[model samples]
Target chain A: MIRQANAVDFWRGLALVMIFVNHIPGNYYGRFTHASYSISDSADLFVFLAGWALRHLVGTPERQPPTWYLVLRLGGRAVTLYAAQIMITMIALAMLASVAILRDNPLLLEWHNAAAVFHDPIPTHVGLAAITHQLGYFDILPLYVVLMVMAPGIAIVDRFAPNLLLPLSLLIYGITLAVPISIPTWPVDGQWFFNPLAWQLVFVLGFVMARPTGIGGVVRQHIVPIRIVALPILIGFVFVMRYGWWPDPTWFPQPRLFFLFDKTFVTPPRVIQFLALVAVISVAYPTIQRYGPRLVDFLSMLGRNSLYVFCVGSVLSLAGQILRYLYRGDIVIDTVVVIFGIAMMAVTAWLPEWRERVKGRPAPKLAPSS
Target chain B: MPAPFSRDCQVGSTATASESPLPNVAAALRDKRKLKILAIGASPSAGRRSARGGHTGETKDILQQAIRGLDVEMINRGVSGELAAQAAIRIRNEVALHEPELVLWQVGTNDALIYVPLGELEQTIVETLRWLKERKVDVVLVGLQYVDRMAQDDHYRLVRELIRKIAAQENVIAVRRYEAQRLLAQAADSGGGLVPDEFQRSETGYVCLSQYLARAITLGVFGGNLRPRELQNLPPRPQN
Candidate 1:
């Protein structure tokens, strides 16, 4: 029997599309992306799903992986993410440099914080390799890399003292927000676009929620009540965000990150909104999968091969921005960009499965929770 | 005397004169013996593309030369091809992080290129300027660069007009880079092509921009209550 497309992959795939649209700043489609009406955009969903995947990687009580194996696997994955970030950042710089030289527009050289690479290549290059300096629109992976490097720690805590896992994550999240602590950029005095310290809360939430025991089990048991409570928040925030109804920043007390709806530090409001969103989607996705099987399959494929599609999407988004600039981002140009760029991402997602088929090996199965 | 960095640098006088007090910048210079400026713009506002560190180095040197024992720390956060909305966001983040007292916001060119809706652009500029004002941060709105094609575009002209209006309304200093470049380009045109058409792409263009900025900043900090002509004709510091 053919397996149905799962919600995890489907939502992850949709998040990828949202990210693609939002990444291309000034694209006409940007007006309709998830961020327009939601306090938290696809970035939060993306990170949360990544943490969900870590649940499988860490394994369950019945078939837990050895601590050493988990460390090596997560470490290797971190290396891959690091390599991808470095390669893409270099490619992005090269793309900007080529366009700048060819079009006789040096301004292209400076887009998305690439000016540092051109102006101060040596230090910036070091910063790039070290993940201390990240190009705009290309920053999420550095956060992923850090989170992946911390995955072993996460697994150890879950394995040994599972009770303390979430409280510890929340404690870190609280400290990050209250102190307004973030990883600072090097070779440039700035903070990371996504603060991993704060983001790890969402990741840990995903991890814990994926489990059938503990708070995850509790949430799963009371999901209907949770959905009821979450529904108003979801509906309420849509209007709140749309109308700009949040309290004024001036009104926020000191250590404002705790109160403000900040993306970088993953503030409380955003987290609350995102969790409410997830709750609502949990119920809605089944109906979606039943009614829109093809759409579900398509998005599931994108989600299954998220890393590959995301890498392709990042480059494509940059290309889309350049194209929009060159041709002007009217609705027509934006439509073409969105359609073509997403198609390329789909192709990227398909190639690995095609390779597996060609090698006479079955495509790897998603983890049980996934 | 012609500006040392660029020969076609007679545009310094055209920088919008501001009676608006740059209180923080003035105070920083007085007490700390240091000045920190964050230059956030599109292209040459970062520095010259052809000449590495050209505009930034030139601006620093001019500022330091003008005020002995004054340390000028400059931050170049110029992302070429950025629109007003995007730049405004970064400006907030950078200001919050770096706490720069003055922001040199070179805007309008890229927004004009993309034909960003006039009201949207105006709102972003007005909102950001007000936010900066709330923080007591001084802003110098460097207007669009002169491009021949954009000169005829009505939307482009409107965007330029909007920048001027916003600058005046916000009481921030404005650098008339477009007017200066257009005048220089026109003069060069009349003189049979002495200056490059794309002033923003050339070494001279960025050098001229740096000189204009350096002069405007120096005058803003020091030449308070001076008339525009006096600010323009202010005597150069004696060479050591």
Candidate 2:
């Protein structure tokens, strides 16, 4: 089934690699990240893929059992991600603490927002577990959990009132952006970096588009027209990014929030650029797949096992940061770290299949017997 | 131009160059002897981690101990990787919500690390400080930390210089975190530890940072108001 949708998986895999590279913050490799050239980064790609994956996982209402069964399954996934967030957060804190203690750098404890764990462990730990607090890079999962919890509802709406969902999702997104509301952080006061309210539109778009429904059908049917609009938008963003030029936020009669290229609430420019990116890239995938079979297969493999690889990649990224701190990693060292980390992720991606073979679950084919 | 002072400056004894910006603090000091200070910036000022950096902790806890016997209500809103621009947007709301007399802003490090254009960084400082000044909020700009890797970093130097320059131009207190930390390291090296180690710059580093800030606040707020005491002679007590 995933093989049929290898492009999604391949893109997700590409997103994973990008996420890993971008997570290092100040690393030399980060300069090459897509965010430098575009408003949307791998975060948009990853979230969109998540929505696509949800559609794939639950094909249609008829294909799934009961609504309760769907809710239970989706709820179970949310719980798993929640547990993973806590586990990874603890490991990251320990990693920071270990580095701080071993290297005699108290600064490490304060860096990456780990100061709460050392300074005020009780409330910070409680906040982290409650999903009210999150470390710098380990934030997306809590958001993923919320989206998963919403999936059953989305599925129900998709099955029954398909036309209602997108507009409703957009309505909520638009109003939130206008009102400028976001979830607040607890134990420490602030707000979530990626506001789920605005981001859900992209996720919902990904979901709605997978099916040849109203808006999705129209867009898919008018590919040429969309591509014609998408190409120039894509090219224009290249200039915007490279030149650091943005539409003036001070436009009269329009709220500054509407135009600013803000990440917290996925602004219009970001959403347009991201959609354009998806359209343009999706249009070319077929050509690339035929020409570069090996590349597609490699990325698709990583994509197929995204959850495992993402968790490992996130952990590995934190480790990479610590190692960079210890070594003061130069460009050469940063490159080596990235290559080695991606290789480890590749091995991790393959390990499940390797184990399945070792257990004789899916024995290798006997060539001579045929 | 006044050089940024280390922790040893007889801070509280001398009036700050300007009047206090925090009317609430001034009012409380005059009426109830309870000064509620809301320090918001990165982790050192006391908030959670922002997107890029994970600087976290109650830098306020350290300050509470540093400024004991002076009913100081220290509220921290430090978010690591929080730029001055972002803080400026959030600050007005914070001022409305918490209503502190003074704001201690630790800035420039995240901007430097991300290679945000110097002009943008300067604009952020200028705009944020100008807004604070208009609102009569007494602000002390805490400069960036000293990292061995940053010595050769031109961008880092520029950010540090900008913070200092802004403070000088605006007649605001600028706590020289880099110089103070470097001084601590030098002192430690002279005392036999060649490297000065991590705690000197981390735990002790934050402790010193908070002390420097707390002392700056005391000097800024209680200069002529409080009975004179050589702040350098009074070491900040750790309120564990």
Estimate TM-scores for all models.
Answer: 0.83, 0.76
Can you tell me which runs of candidate 2 are displaced by over 4 Å? A1-5, A247-255, A357-370, B1-41, B44-78, B81-105, B108-140, B145-172, B178-240
In the range B1-240, model 1's lDDT, one tens digit per residue, is: 112334356533454344456778888888975577887766533333322344666777777776678798877666555678878866875676557888989898878766788999999999999988888788888888775655777887999899989888888788788776666665555553346545233334566777777767776776654444433443332121
What DockQ do the predictions score, one after another?
A: 0.24, 0.19
Instruction: Write down the worst ten-residue block by lDDT for model 2 chain A.
Output: A247-256
What local lDDT does model 1 show for residue A337?
A: 93
| Docking level of model 2 | incorrect
Worst ten-residue run, lDDT, model 1 chain A?
A247-256
- Docking quality tier of model 1: acceptable
On DockQ, the candidate that comes out on top is: 1
